[model samples]
Target: MKQYEYKFSFLPEAINDCEKVSDLETTCEVKGKYPCPCCCYNTFPVPKEDAIAYICPVCFWENDVFTSSDDEPSDENRGMTLNEGRRNYKILGACSQDMLIHVREPKSDEFPK
Candidate 1:
């Protein structure tokens, strides 16, 4: 699993050497913002390293630090794997069928180009 520090800063100077993404596919380097693993939307406030869990507002997948692999089931996520969450998001518009009511559609600016 990858580790990331949570930071909150709008100033460009706040970005430092620690905020570097080695893999765009699975990590976010930007300060105070992180890509939701389930939705791929840059909306998470806390990075994967910070234990304060965040559920994506768009897809409703709870951020769990350990389950970075798409195939691995996460206890923190109610035993749902990243792949299952992604598939559920496509079909139900949320990370799980039951989460449809808990999630909202991504804003126009939230989708990755």
Candidate 2:
């Protein structure tokens, strides 16, 4: 698998207010610019009440759901298999204390490679 590094940021005030920094709720203001692990495609992040799951832009399947092992498929994973080619689908990443604010181009001064 290829490794992709991206920068993430969080407001100090937001971090301080949350009981658990990793559980902070996020609202994707951009609407449709989330990261896509497969083929490095750019798309919207999957939204959830408390968290988001990282999804493939082209495949429209959650990363976890897409990468699930074949032997132990759960109900959720089973559902994902059905919509592997839908458009406008998204997936959220694992919850973390650090929330990503910007995704800049490589070699840019704001986000150096």
Candidate 3:
């Protein structure tokens, strides 16, 4: 029963393909503009995904950012609209900031657990 969740994101000074990480172990990886993970102050990665309704007037909390094949975007990570035109649905954050590596959960469950 290990479930520690913290949502609030950013980290995109320049994203082409998309993929950023920071769980903070030793520190030093957060490129350009910082302070986001609920740090309050916002807006860094913007090229406009065509008004996706980003509502978060400091923790009103209604933005998923992106990257969710499955892991709960909460509200069950919703669905529909794949962003076929591109921009792949914003949010390139958290690829691995802490906990280094290890994932087996329900996908089959058998690895070094």
Best by TM-score: 1
Per-residue lDDT for 23 in model 2?
A: 29
lDDT against the true structure, each candidate: 0.76, 0.34, 0.29
lDDT of 2 by residue, 48-70 (tens): 22224553323334444433443
Runs of candidate 2 with Cα error greater than 4 angstroms are 1-30, 46-57, 63-75, 79-113
Instruction: Please provide, for model 3 over 1-113, each residue's C-alpha lDDT reduced to its tens digit, 9 standing for 90 to 100.
Output: 99999655675465589556666544432121221222123331332232143432222222344634333333411332223111222232212222113211111221112
lDDT of 1: 0.76
Best to worst by lDDT, what's the order?
1, 2, 3
- TM-score of predicted model 3? 0.16
Query: Which of the numbered candidates is closest to the native, going by highest lDDT?
Result: 1
Worst 10 residues of 3 by lDDT: 103-112
* Candidate 1 lDDT, 1-113, residue by residue in tens: 99999776865664466655566466532332667888888777666567357778888888788766879888878999989999888888899888888777776667776
- The true-structure Cα RMSD of candidate 2 reads 19.0
Candidate 1 or 3, higher TM-score? Answer: 1
Superposed on all Cα atoms, the candidates' RMSDs to the truth, in angstroms, are 15.7, 19.0, 22.1
Candidate 3 — which residues are off by over 4 angstroms? 1-22, 26-40, 47-60, 64-113
TM-score order of candidates, top first: 1, 2, 3
Between 1 and 2, whose lDDT is larger? 1
